[model samples]
Target: MEFATFILAAQRGYHQSSESVIRNSIEQAVASEQAGFNTAWFAEHHFNNYSLIPSPLMMVAHCAGLTSTIRLGTAVCVLPLY
Candidate 1:
């Protein structure tokens, strides 16, 4: 069996700052790797507070240093928007 984690990087409301949301997402990825997850996936979003991640590839680059074994990927990328 394989396990993976999807990081939504969602902000419920104004109570959560953008920095905190992104930081939390990074933390989640690190923790997921430590927990033996096979992969850590990031979601892409733009121009909205619902999801703060603009580029999953950038997020993957940031997390690559934090995790050594776990694979990293984007759940989905809206190419038209890029």
Candidate 2:
């Protein structure tokens, strides 16, 4: 079976910085690739802490260079927000 991971990039509390959340998400993608995962999925959200990534496409682009083999995709994109 193919393995994959969903990166929510959630900040559970105010104690965590936005920068760290995004950074950790990127790291997760890289780690997932190294761990032989088939794909890494990112969540997109705006104006809320549910998910810090406003654009999963941007996240994928940022991670494209960090990972070599694992596929990257967005769990969902709210086009109306754009």
Candidate 3:
């Protein structure tokens, strides 16, 4: 079985900046791969409150160099929404 984690840059507290959340999420994905996870999935969202990732492809591209074996994916995305 392949283990995976949903990577969402969530702003749970007032001090958590969007940039930091996104950076941390990327770091977590790399860590997840190192920890033996099979995949790292990103959340796609247009709104600001829920998630910081608007494009999973963008995240995948950014993380491609940072990760070696872990596969990257998106949870949900409407093609025409953008």
Q: Using Cα atoms with residue i matched to residue i, what is each candidate's TM-score against the true structure?
A: 0.94, 0.95, 0.90
**Cα miss at 51, model 1 (Å)?**
0.9
Q: Which candidate has the highest TM-score of all?
A: 2
Candidate 2: count the clashes: 0
Question: Per-residue error at 61 for model 1, in Å?
Answer: 0.5
Ranking 1 against 2 by TM-score, winner: 2
In candidate 2, residue 76 scores what lDDT? Answer: 87
Error of 1 at 53 (Å): 0.3
- What lDDT is obtained when candidate 1 is compared to the true structure? 0.93
Model 2, 3-42: lDDT tens per residue? 9999999999999999999999999999999999999999
What RMSD value applies to candidate 2? 0.9
RMSD of each: 0.9, 0.9, 1.2
For model 3, residues 49-75, the per-residue Cα lDDT tens digits are 578888888898899889989998887
Better of 2 and 3 by lDDT: 2
Evaluated against the true structure, the overall lDDT of model 3 is 0.86
List lDDT for all candidates, in order. 0.93, 0.94, 0.86
Ranking by TM-score: 2, 1, 3
Off by over 4 Å in 2: none
**Which regions of candidate 1 fall more than 4 Å away from where they truly are?**
none
The TM-score that candidate 3 achieves is 0.90
